[model samples]
Target: MKLTTSKGARALVLVALVATVGACGLPRSGPNKREIFAGSVLKQGDAYVVTVNSRVTRATAVMPAFGFGSSFRNAGVVGSDTINAGDLLALTVFENVKDDPLLGNTGQRVSLLDQVQVDGQGYIFVPYAGKVKAAGQTPDGLRQILTKKLDSQTPDPQITVQRLAGDGQTVSVSGAVTGQGVYPIERPTRTLSTMLAKSGGIAIEPAVAIVRVTRGGQTGKVWLQDLYENPGLDIALRGGDQIVVERDQRAFTALGATGAQSLVPFESQTLSAIEAIAQVGGLATSLADPTGVFVFRNEPAEIANSVLGRKDLRGDQRMVYVLDLTQPTGMFEARDFLIRDGDTVYVTEAPFVQWTKTIGAITGTAGAADSLASVGSSGG
Candidate 1:
């Protein structure tokens, strides 16, 4: 067929072709295929890529391992079991004073005692003794010592001793708790689990909760679930220790052709690569490359050395890990591989997705020409 078209009609066809090219969702900087950090990984040579087996075996070796409740259990206040410099004491003294009319009415005996704050010198003044050492002594021991010293001052002396306030036997529980205050430990129940229960237990995300115990300027952290599962980790709490229960937002960033591309939080404390992939809505069906799933993380020097199998790394401390989901063993490998906090899961686009889009755009552009051709032929 001999085809001739007016300038206006040709211009309309050209405009329609342009519109079709623009509508098919061509790849761009923000397209699902455009990975967020792929450029940086290419530019920076420090990123190391590892497979499922290497990632699971070597990368896990260097993570910082921490134990909780040591401060609570082995705390000096808990183990010492005695009065300290800051402790408060309440004492009562009874004496038989016959013919003592000034000592309260017709009573032949008199009793007197008062609260005494332990001084910086670790001593408290008694009725007769000028200064008696009270720190480091148990209430019973102090009672005996006071009873002996008052022997000459009061006849048939009876002395009672009680701790008015035990600042050393109390712990502070805060963060993600129903009650944020000080809790006293009076018995042997100084375990962290028990102490947490005494303070109304933990709140926020218990499954992924981080329980941080601070004592004497040193702090240690353990998962709340770890304490529940491991009895040994539920170590006793110590006096003056501080406990903080906070939700672990163990989050990872998802990019590339994944169903969701954003910061995603792991539902639980322990997470495998497969679980993390699924949690981020899985990879996009058409655009995702099953063979190109990658996880980017900042590996410690030790971990990086182990992963690269060298004493020195060629790139930065950052490392890259890839999993080929196309293989039959990929799913199981991912199950064994763990995801760390602040990891980036990138799912690259399949080669065919771009071809399919390009072909679709061509057909769309052709369709516009065909429609215009039909109109021109009918008019002829």
Candidate 2:
């Protein structure tokens, strides 16, 4: 069949072709306002479409609570001055008898014993003083015990016990820190914050930094900032404790007509909807529909019930929260609305965008048809 080149026939064909394109639907970032409204629970879709309001903001304003529990908080600071098994002690014995010194040579009144390790059974052996319990005792306490033990062997023997920094009473600091090593628990580094400092402090941002402490079989985690803000969270360090500092792994997905589509990490302890939008450089100005900003999340049963005002919902519920920035209170509602990990913030394209795209398609088609008509007329 010969192709029609007449202007009248071409106009009719262009109208039909445009109609087909319109019926098939034009390209869009995501669902429009009407399509979103149609997907509400009241409609055929399973998602609950809620308009952002003060109530919805409060219902979803929950934040992650990262801190120590009662067990960790109740623990007292470890005594840095106290002696423990595996610790090295330096002992000095001073005797008044110069002629017959038991521990020292003749004319020598002082005897020094270096690197006296406390045994696993918490006992330390001294020459002529025998075995004495040293793990639970302080340096001064051990000295008094040694003085009494050696009084029978030496006349008025004075003893001094000094605790040395060793592997015992130490914590292993690792992960996101300026320095990662085994640090001794001293008077200044007996607590969580002080120990972190002794390791050259946290290497990550304080806002997103998490401090995890594992003592024995139990482990506790708290935000690095909270560790200082809340005194109770800064628990004392213990022997054989493992400390790790790391960044929060929570993030959300940005899709549709936002400035950029990617996984955005939580930059602060708490994130609001507006802040999240800003983190992605806000919406695409030319294509975004201010009235069609949506947040997609699968809320827990408890939060879903609170949001929908119905207790019948169980398990995770798919929810789409709509924000109309054109309204007077829309900006405020978005400001108060909190974003959670794994949420998807989507901004639909303006309704006019599809129409403009359709127009461009129609014009391009017309231009091609006119060129074909000109070529056919020339051939005839």
RMSD of each: 4.7, 2.3
> Tens-digit lDDT track for model 1 on 1-380?
34555445656786778676777668731333234344444655445556667455545633336585444445432543477666778787666766552223456565555568778778888767568998889889998898888786667677788887766467889999878898766654466888788778777777778889887888888888888888777766666778999887668888888778889887886678888879978878867888888887887776677766778664447766778877888887787788888888888888777778777776777677777867876787
lDDT for each candidate structure:
0.73, 0.88
Position 120, candidate 1: lDDT: 71
Structural similarity to truth (TM-score) of each candidate:
0.77, 0.94
- The per-residue C-alpha lDDT of model 2 at residue 27 equals 73
**Between which residue pairs do clashes occur in model 1?**
46-315, 46-316, 48-320, 72-236, 72-237, 72-238, 73-236, 190-236, 190-237
Write one digit per residue (lDDT tens) for candidate 2, span 140-236: 9999999888998888998888998655788999999999999988889989999999999989899999999988888889999888898777788
Q: Which one is best on lDDT?
A: 2
Please tell me which predicted candidate would have the highest TM-score against the true structure.
2
Model 2 has a clash total of 0
